[model samples]
Target: MEQKLLNSPQSEVNVIDSLFAEMVLDKALLDFRKKKIQQKIDQSLQDRNKREFLRLSEKLKDLS
Candidate 1:
């Protein structure tokens, strides 16, 4: 890692870009899971399933 830092400036830029890309991917995945869980919660509500609704609600809250 020290050697890479001592290398050219282009290497540093590449490292930074990769880190940013990873963060974006992570955020997208989290959003997808939260959205899916929310949908389930809504369905549970429509079906009048209190147990499922509460469970899904907790799962969604944890994501937030």
Candidate 2:
């Protein structure tokens, strides 16, 4: 850190502002990726359930 920046209030404010912005951006990116992953997981579960249901139905039909 520069000695001049340590003595300057404006420089401190600027550093804080930049850090805050970076944190906000990181959080937003994390949220977006989380949502995408959850969507994929949900879709996979739905597909598995449908396949299971179809298999059971076929088994029932063969029993008739």
Candidate 3:
């Protein structure tokens, strides 16, 4: 029982570390996607494409 108690913290730490890694990955992916969408939105403006602009705007809004 003493050994089990000592080993339990390691398991808890592993779970916490795994969750942190996942959160970092998710944030990075989200930042990448938002950057890409903004680029498209800018291009849409430069090209004077109203339809594309509105569509990309909604996509960017949905991310937030």
The 0-to-1 C-alpha lDDT of every candidate, in the order given, reads 0.92, 0.69, 0.95
RMSD of 2: 13.3
Ranked candidates, highest lDDT first: 3, 1, 2
Candidate 3 local distance difference test against the native: 0.95
lDDT by residue (1-64, candidate 3, tens digit) is 4454546988889889999999999999999999999999999999999999999999999998
Using Cα atoms with residue i matched to residue i, what is each candidate's TM-score against the true structure? 0.86, 0.65, 0.89
TM accuracy, model 3 = 0.89
After superposition, candidate 1 runs with Cα above 4 Å error: 1-6
Give the poorly placed runs of model 2, Cα more than 4 Å off: 1-6, 49-64
Candidate 2 vs 3: which has more lDDT: 3
**Ten residues in sequence with the least summed lDDT for candidate 2:** 55-64
Q: How many residue pairs clash in each candidate?
A: 0, 0, 0
Candidate 2 per-residue lDDT, tens place, 1-64, comes to 6456566998889899999999999989877766665565566567887665555555545534
Model 3 residue 37 lDDT?
A: 100
- Candidates by TM-score, descending order: 3, 1, 2
Q: lDDT (0-100) at residue 2 of candidate 3? A: 44
User: Candidate 1, residues 3-64: lDDT per residue as tens digits?
Assistant: 65547898988889999999999999999999999899999999999999999999898889
